[model samples]
Target: MKVNYTGFQASEVSPYLEVHQALKAADHRNGKPDVLAYTSVARMNPYQALLYRSFPDHGFAVAPLLKPFELRDLMLHKSRASSITLHLHWVNWVLAGEPDAQRAQTKVSGILGRIDRFKQLGGKLVWTAHNVYPHDAAHLEAELALQQGIADRSDVIHTMAASTTAALAEYTNVDAQKVLVAPHPHYRGAYEDVTSRAEARAVLGIDDDETVFLVFGALKEYKGLLRTLEAFDQLLDQDPSGRYRLLVAGGADDHPDVQEFISRGLLHDRVLMEPSKIPGSKAQYFLRAADAGLVTYTRSLNSGAALLYQSFGLPVLATDTPVLRETLPPHTALFLDANAAVDEYAAQLKALRALARSTTQTDVLDGIAHLDPSAVSSTFAQDLRSRLGLRQH
Candidate 1:
């Protein structure tokens, strides 16, 4: 049941299913690829799975997880396919996590050099601007250079939000001409939404009276858990009826505030914090049990969590970030000012509770019907193919 969020190969999964996937991948390996990916996607996230599902007929496989210097090795084995396209998702990999500015700059330069070599070898590159900048930035200068370099060399710069162009432009120059706006697809078919609130509540032992505000995803500091916990504590203090509850289920980072929140037993009754990655099968339980999804992100460029909540028909109580402005569907969200105080977020939480009570769940679910994966998958797949200069079948 315990996975390191990255390394855990829990027995909760079916070996037969994995082998089936592997067999399919093997088939793609033997055939010439129409579109091959080079991404550092973690084992936990379903974004990659949902994405590649767009190409059922075409031979699309994750080619490799090569490091910056190691990409040159791919030159030895060239695909004979007319289009040799590679999508490098999360370009921050080379520039992120290095604290030393000089080292970070060096890392960026080395990757840039590799990218130049890849271009020389006739490999078309498409860069997805997933984040404006890392929330926990250690070297801003290096990251800026990396972003600029990627934008310059990318045949297509795919962005999920139009606001991302402006947000990223604040730090690095973004070419509007090359930018393609492909909205983050919802998790409609990714997780089952068949579980009713009553069934889910009983499974989690949640009372029907409790106004559950669910916080799902990795328990990172930039996720604004401190402010969220503070705001939740404030709400509980004001309401003696004990009708409110906050359920935080995700893998925890080593943030001191979050660690304290995880350690404390005082608020266990009102605040249920599951400090681990929730498995895919169990995702429905959290989604169906909650009245509304809660997110108090301090800063972010993209929020898949918002889309996940929307996919499941749960309205979100979220910080009003530019990304969320473009991402959230109508009548499905209660926004708190991104620059607001903890007390203001608490007020929004209360407002969200009110909103959830007034609106029918069917109405909320209907709001996100347009976001079904089938709706966007074909468009996104086509845009990507066009950018890569691959002719549509």
Candidate 2:
């Protein structure tokens, strides 16, 4: 089958790379619903090349998609099968043009119309609910309208966490029956030449005895980076002689709060900040250097960072959200209320630091065996074939 996946490129920060790689791996063994990637451009990003280099024999192929106007023309003139076999659109990235309200509305309306038309032409529409709404939504109502329209039109609405199904239905009024819950796959062998924990810590200038807590991934307003900083500061105050360090790694957003925090000179010495896009080869260095990963999101539907941390057999200190609670095992992760006081968060950090000192890597992996990438990929392939009425080869 010719599956056209939108909002996917080889070098995206989202789950597209992992999901596609897993599906490609699975399809090699169990050939069902043969898939090909659809991109707007021909060139692969450097990071994409790094990730795909090892899978040289992987059967996936990348082809260009019809341009916006060309897509409209095809929907009007061509048969559904000729136009495309299956359309799998992801996240709010596909719903572009947000600043100009009129333009955004027109684009959204056109896309929704195309979705309806695509279905009418016997093509399938799949929308993966990466978030309840766009994180950087400029035009709120227009974005929500587009989400609702997509939810209303999609043949299948995919969410990583089961808890997100009800939240998505509530937000977009999508039917519960239309939602398919599939857990995000683990990052087993995504990176190359990963650094050892000791080597990583040494290179980062962290001492062997220092307890490092990492806030990995893109630093955004909703991620509670400031709160994590506050809690870490309080922890330092409480234990003046403690060897605790904070590693805030990943891209920094243009949010005023984030910029303000950066300008305050808080990230120095013990607080190391790498405000850049971490390459796939260097991802393991960050993960290995830290004793535990922090997910202090003020709000979230699901956190891919948490899964990445867990996949490395690293313990996580996460804010208590319904989605995190549902997805992470209680024994492996330490959770606190989203609105917990700084002192309370400080205490939890102290506790996690002590726990991390004694916890073995194997202990962290014991409870999350189901998050294995192979299992997740098989499930994803099976679900797609089942929903699209395609036979398993």
Candidate 3:
């Protein structure tokens, strides 16, 4: 079965890359989905010199989604072109408040009308719920309307987690039977170990023995950077000589909380922030250099970062939120109740740092082996085939 994925942006850092990579790998493996096409909403508009670049090969006919009329014509005649299997990566524009919401909704409604026609033409619709509902109140009504529109048009809906699926079902027009929870496909790059404890420290310009706690990703409000800083400060008071350094590797310029952390003397050189995106390969270096990975998301669904840490065997110290509890074992790394005392949180981090050195590194690496690319890609392919009414073999 051939498949076409429609998303806001297919090549950017979001989970759409996971969809592209998984589909590409599946095509290589089973040689089914005979064809895969990727259309990006951003690509439809002319923009240039964006700081980020797209992955050159996603094994799909990548294109810009043209105007509403063009989209209708394309979908209406997709059989002469390729099979239409719409995957809704995001519905932000269709849900309003974004730039040109009126125009975007007009275009999207035309496409939805075309999708209804596609079903009559024997096309399949698989809408992936990257977000169940927009969190902001301003977007609530528009989001619900878009949800109902997709529900009315789609043959099935796929969500990354059961929790997300359940949340999505609260919206009208979503048939509970049509939603399936598929875990986000795991991602693995070639395993590159830190050169050495000393060498890893040298690369990051830190002392070999300094205790490091790593925080990865663009600093977002609910990600709990402030809480993480507070915890780190508490840890420092216990042992000022502990030399606990927080190597913050990700874009942080947009977050005022980060600057607040710096200006308030909560962090000095101990808190390092990367103003740009880091290459995938060098990710492990930061992971390995740190004593443990830190995730203080006061609010989150699930973190690919936490999974990445788990895969590398780097123990995670995260708030005991629904998503965190699902992925991590209690005390294997450290899990603190969101309301836990700062001292309690500090103690957990302190213990992990001490125990981390003596813990078998191979154990951590071995655990992550389950998250290897081949396993995730295979699972993704089987699911895609099943959704497309094609036999995997």
Candidate 4:
């Protein structure tokens, strides 16, 4: 049996092959796809999927880079590396969840070796610098080694913020010549935004007058979920009216402290805790219910979650990081000192009690139309094709 996938094809079904791979077994005539996006998302997550959505239109085949983090299979099939471009995004998967520095080094070393060999085979690589280090911020040596090695080899170091080059230069080697600044897409059309605010709040048991402060995305420490929780605790202690409702929802992490803190937060009447990945169909419920997005990232090169908030027309309460300041317009968000005290956080929350979003959803979208995913990805694909000297469609 044969099936077509996004105009790419599979001659026979194979569980191991990505959408780009055909299961004919012997004919390696068309091996791996032309563009492989390595990501932190699930195999078909919108983050990576939407990125290359315009690729097919631009005459390129795309697929998620499958596991084992090596190109040995391509080598085994005698595939030419010149035909492929590996796009890396938040590649902490190379750490393999090993906290120990020694084991971490071994894992990173293996992947680096494979990348080196891929380059040797005439492959070009594009690395999107999503973070300076992994969320846990562990194993400085191994992380730095991996990034420095990649920076030296990457044909383009893509980033969502202009500050990426300077921010990364503080800790790792960054060749400015290799840097390319692009926009992070707002998840406007990605989520099912079917529910109205009233209906969402009603289902979620939120009160009409209460202002919901949403802390979304995975509960990683680097994202400042714990700090957000701590401020909510202080806010509760100081205010009796409880107008500020804390809505913490997302895929929870396995870290003991994070799990414990979020667990404690669930007990509070003012706190609404989903503590799991919200289904795409239900993503709008939280966004529509909340008035302001809470981003307490201690460090970040860029934030898709922030863009996600603005996509739904909600303003954000974010740490005043350089990247956020540069990427987001001032009208779309209220900034907080990144290194402020818990008291300062509580005060900020107090100040936000009656705050209203200055910009409507339309205005938010209009301000950055140039950065819209459709345009940005199309430009990216066309530019990529030009860089490779591929024929223009």
Q: Estimate, for each residue in 88-140, the C-alpha lDDT of model 3 and write its tens digit.
A: 55555443455554655565566578667756766566676654454332445
lDDT of each: 0.73, 0.67, 0.57, 0.72
Q: What ordering of candidates by lDDT runs from best to worst?
A: 1, 4, 2, 3
Residue-by-residue lDDT tens digits, candidate 1, 1-393: 873332124233322222223334534544555535456555567776666666644444334343434565444435444445557787666766677888898888888888898789987888888777765567877777887888899899888888888888778788888988877777877876678889998998899999999999888877877778888888888876859988878888788977877776235688876789899888899888998997768777788898888777778887787788777865778888767897888888888888888877677768766666665666777777776777654
Better of 3 and 4 by TM-score: 4
For candidate 1, list the clashing residue pairs, or say none. Answer: none
Candidate that beats the other on lDDT, 1 or 2, i.e. the better one? 1
Candidate 4: tens digits of C-alpha lDDT, residues 32-111: 33544343445324776667667766655554455536454444323422255667777777875686989888887888
Instruction: Flag clash pairs in model 3.
Output: none
The alpha-carbon deviation from the true structure for residue 39 of candidate 3, after best TM-score superposition, in angstroms, is 6.3
What 10-residue stretch in candidate 1 is worst by lDDT? 6-15
- Tell me the deviation in Å of residue 106 in model 4: 2.7
Q: Which stretches in model 4 have alpha-carbon errors above 4 Å?
A: 1-16, 19-45, 75-82, 237-239, 357-359, 387-393
Winner by lDDT: 1
Q: What is the number of residue pairs that collide in model 3? A: 0
Model 3 residue runs over 4 Å out of place are 1-77, 80-82, 91-122, 131-140, 144-152, 167-176, 190-194, 253-255, 262-267, 329-331, 339-341, 391-393
lDDT of 2 by residue, 200-306 (tens): 98888888888889888887898877777888888888897998899877878899988875655254556987877787778878888889999878877777788
